[model samples]
Target chain A: MTQTDLAAFLAHSVELESEARERYLELADAMRAHHNTEVADFFMRMAHESGLHLEEVAQIAAENALPDLKPWEFDWPGEESPETASYEAIHYRLSLRQAIQLALENELAAQAFYASFAQSSADATTAELAAQFAHEESQHAAQLSVMLKELPPDDAHHREDDDDPHMPE
Target chain B: MNDVITFKAKDYKSGVKPIWCPGCGHFSVFNAVTKAMAGLGMNKDDTVLVSGIGCSSRLPAYVDSYGFHGVHGRGLAIAQGLKVARPELTVIAMGGDGDGFSIGGNHFMHACRRNVDITYVVMDNEVYGMTKGQASPTTPMDWDHSKLTPHGPGVRPFKPAALALAAGAPWIARAYSGNPNQMAHLLAQAIEFPGFSFLHVLSQCITFCPQQTDWKAIVNERQDAALEDEDEAARLFLHEDGFQTGLLYQRQRPTWPPEAAPPNDPDLTGGFRL
Candidate 1:
């Protein structure tokens, strides 16, 4: 699980972005089910960002022999890829504020993952690559943090859409 | 078709994204299925997803592969026919517990006995999710959440893996939705198995059975390794509470229709082949 070489580290990076993109798309579609179009669109935009990053990493590593590690084989810090949102956090009525906060937290976690590798990896080239990824993740987190601040002060507590969760009769 | 070097789970996904509830376990299963397909390098044009009616039956709509969204409880029958007609294509049949064990119980039994070269996956949520949450054939006898079964179904649930082996399926495995990675691993193996392979997925219907979230802590890996002996597997299934997940049994046999099937009879087939 430890990234001892550049190929392994790049593989992990690609996996992280892939997972993040999938999770965002899931959240967006789930929100759409509850008619939360605004939040859904926001999540879609985040997914696009992740997709772009994933493309860049994949394009460069297409020729490299990235190890095809099983899903459980990945040595992720959390239960899943650092950038993937927690399943417990998903809901049909998730508010835009909560969605943004969740994304921000995931970005921070990804940044931390790359940062730890940058500091602990013994291989100099791998460490440098991890550092670059860490910087990029930090920027993503900062942007999300700003989005969080710009929302209404009470939005943080706005996890669920309305007080009632019952379907209309 | 895709090369291993170009493996991408998203490539196996359709244009529409899955939209299950907040705590719904199907999300994980969906991801696991796509990951498994990508890992196997399955060709979208050659891989077929057949399903009966239910929440899980909607799976075909989410995958980019060829799909046959058939009527309720006929998934196995249809999938078997498809695989027999086109032996070269990879066929996967999937649906909910209600559809597979109740309405299609007869077909399920025969599918196991016939030993067709296809995969069958049952998303056993233990409740009829699409019909607003009623106790399913696999619902616990003690479960009393549904008003219709407020005092509990008071009926023993169908033991899927045990039943599969009894009916003569060559491969049987149980997987938990809480562990998508493990589910994906098992799925790839089941798909590669060259005979009737049944994978029972304990997918939680969080919208109705919110308590199922606790399955994360309750479910455990099987204590014993994969068993090839039917009697040993039977004894294992009989004693366990069915919370254990892993490859419980495998006994490959020559697939059905030992030779190419004869020309289809329009009377029986109605000239409608999958």
Candidate 2:
């Protein structure tokens, strides 16, 4: 919650990326199991991106005396980490468009979270680091937006019988 | 143990992707379980997750630890037996509303009063999701979404936390899958609780009950929800709607089998005298 301290900032950043990567991988696996290969592959790509960003955060964490914090201890703007996409917005039958949109939304939330710390942190070092992270998140969001724009119109739909197929009479 | 690497939340997963619907709340509950394990640095081999038949019952297969996907509505029974016999293992029983509060309703009540040193997690989506939507024991009296209950079940739903409290459970809590952080925190606390601990989780069955998607906005954490006093907790449960989530009730009680059991009898008829 205290983003002013470099240790706290790094801890939060590391958790945000870690949680994001885990969620994307979970989503990818779920879709893959359901035979939604296209959406699954898209989620895996997003997971790869999250993993790369996580490596950067982990590298920074290695250089600093990062504080150990519980998963629930982080004071995020919402109930979950900013980059962890809301479960309500995704489903196994999700189309490629929805997946890209969800990724973009996560990136935007992460960018806003970092921008908040960049503008409000009392520690100059934390502020500079937050600004750099914010810029990176913005680039990711922009890339997702372009992906969304390029998606074919027919690729943005869920299965017609996406609901249950075996209700007992 | 020294040769073991520290497990993160993901590392606790069994690598089997859950077949739950995309927006189903069980996904988040699964994450919360793994998070709690990682937070406690629990040894996977020493921990066992047990479940009965239901959509949520598939949970055991997703965990990297020892698991028992038992018969319908019998998870708590199996878990209790395992814990009592093993004594050294950590046991957690899990299932959905229909499985726990309906078919296993009797077992649920007795499990609470038995005061076994185990944790019961009921993912209350208020429907029989595996059956493709039927009114569960915890479903509201007037829920008419299912054709089977065209005029509604017209029966008041079971208040799990209240029931647990009345059945003499020492620790009771309510959590929402939408609030994964708090859910994980509560789960860790429940697992560590000495006596019988009951955690009622509001997990949505998005395929059968899409209206439940609104639960994220409806549920709220209340500071005054948890109480150490039995009388006050009963009054609070009577007054509050199910929306209030957190550790709802807690009280210290003597565990049934005690924390650690005596050494196992060598003879099969050793306890026949009883």
* Every model: Cα RMSD to truth: 5.2, 3.4
Give lDDT tens digits, candidate 1, residues B17-85: 665665577787888888888777777888999999998898999999899999899999899999989
- Please state the Cα-based DockQ of model 2 relative to the true two-chain complex: 0.51
Interface RMSD of 1: 4.0
Q: Can you write out model 2's per-residue Cα lDDT over A66-134, one digit (the tens) per residue?
A: 775767778899999999988887766688887898899999999999999999999999999999999
lDDT of 2 by residue, B1-274 (tens): 2136667788899988799877789999999999899888899999999999999999999999999999998999999999999978999999999999889999999999999999999999999988778899989898887889977899999888788888888899999989899999999999999888999999987777778888888998978756899899888777678888898888888987855565497675877777
CAPRI docking class of candidate 1: acceptable
- Please, what is the TM-score per model? 0.85, 0.91
Error of 1 at B175 (Å): 1.8
Residue B209 of model 1 has an lDDT of 74
Q: lDDT score, residue A125, model 1?
A: 85
Candidate 1's C-alpha lDDT?
0.84
